[model samples]
Target: MAEGFLRPSNGRMEDEGNKYFNDLLANSFFQYVKRNECEIVTSCKMHDLALQVSKSEALNLEEGSAVDGASHIRHLNLVSRGDDEAALTAVDAKKLRTVFSMVDVLNGPWKFKSLRTLKLRRSDITELPDSICKLRHLRYLDVSDTAIRALPESITKLYHLETLRFTDCKSLEKLPQKVRNLVSLRHLHFDDPKLVPAEVRLLTRLQTLLIFAVGPDHMVEELGCLKELRGALKICKLEQVRDREEAEKAELSGKTMNRLFASLAHKQGTVLSMIFWRVVCAIRQKW
Candidate 1:
């Protein structure tokens, strides 16, 4: 609905686009369910009548709908209810641009040629099938909070991928070493701080890198090359920084980083002073 209201002159909406949402709440179209201590509504439950009306207009291919009538469907969400495995197994939506699933496990020799976004958050998928590399057009993928352990090396073939998220995937021990080949990558979210490789300097287009652990293989100076970094950055094991010169080379002040958290393994007065001054400079620039 907000997309429909964008101005024809600029293709952008002037407001935050909450007017329709407020109107719905005012007219009792949606029931408020939860609120924060500040009295801000946090959750809303749509009236059953509205839900039914929405389903009546949308084609849910997962509900035993015929694929013959779904060739034009651009979005597909496969929500499993234990018995819905057969429904997922029968899906053949090649034209689908988005595919989201919330299932314990996905059983597939799957193929979606045109898919651009794939999210399988919290699923029991332990590994991505080799066929996933065939998605040449895939741009966004989130397998966060899952039981995955390792990603196939073929994942490096996703040259067009822009954002990859695997936060809270505790069992994942490593990422493809050639991940830097993804030149288009802009956002990378991971749970383990040590998982980031020094080769990340190759991803000069990166904007959001949540946790960076300084280690023998990944030096803090490597961060100097990532001038596009934004948002918050948490650099752990700061003791690995060789000297003040190396810290200066990180170029933290050159970027638009808003928040920074540094954990030092050493408490030497000189080192601490240098780090403190650099951080203060960065913070001052942010302000």
Candidate 2:
């Protein structure tokens, strides 16, 4: 392991042998968790640091004394707006793994075996920890309204995840390459043009596939591949104006996009007719 360096909030680096701030951080981390719930283990260190301590004395101590294993931490939310330290300090995520946060929550491979759902919407998080993929029992993951740019390659490990929402994740650029492994996903939502790469055709089990910048001319053929689509899909593009040529191409692709809708509309029935009409209107530039 690399030696711990004392990097303070003022953007200055201290000596690696500086045990003063290091011990201060350890104490502050422990005190922060104690002040919050006193029943969970939380820390403000980066995932690397948190993971290090999580596997070492700090987390083990918390597990033994604060909470009985990972069973007590049922809900966790780190602060949405703060310096890295403040955000890290707010995270008391310990044994009770079923968690909800708008912060970067996955500090380490989820050790809690009973965790089933995780919600981290609007937390300004950027990357998902690869350790998250270890949660085989996870059923829900919401990362809406955050600045998250992409998912980890290991995301396909969540075999039990059913509802995955990424609403308003403006910076997200691509889905995990292993997304095909998410055969259990029922809802996949995003509205960033960068997020809708052609690889999206892999999600065959998606019921609600929301995208940005869907045009009649842009891979309408791929829409037919999502055979499990049973709910409404919304396509959004910001600031770009729609023209007649775009409308015509969408009208042509509308035949297929609408057919995909027909399969889904059958299950949802008239409730979706209006929604599909709105979708068609958006694609056709009638909006």
> What does candidate 2's lDDT look like per residue over 78-164, in tens digits?
333433233223334344445555446566433545566677787757888877777777777888898888788888888867778
List model 1 lDDT by residue over 56-81, tens digit each: 32335445445444444566666553
The numbered model that scores best in TM-score is: 1
Give the root-mean-square deviation of each candidate in angstroms. Answer: 5.8, 17.9
Count of backbone collisions in candidate 2: 11
> How many pairs of residues collide in model 1?
0
In candidate 1, position 34 carries an lDDT of 77
Residue 130 deviation, candidate 1, in Å?
1.9
Weakest ten-residue segment in model 2 by summed lDDT: 256-265
lDDT of 1 at 107: 51
Q: Per-residue lDDT for 179 in model 2?
A: 73
Looking at model 1, residue 7 earns an lDDT score of: 39
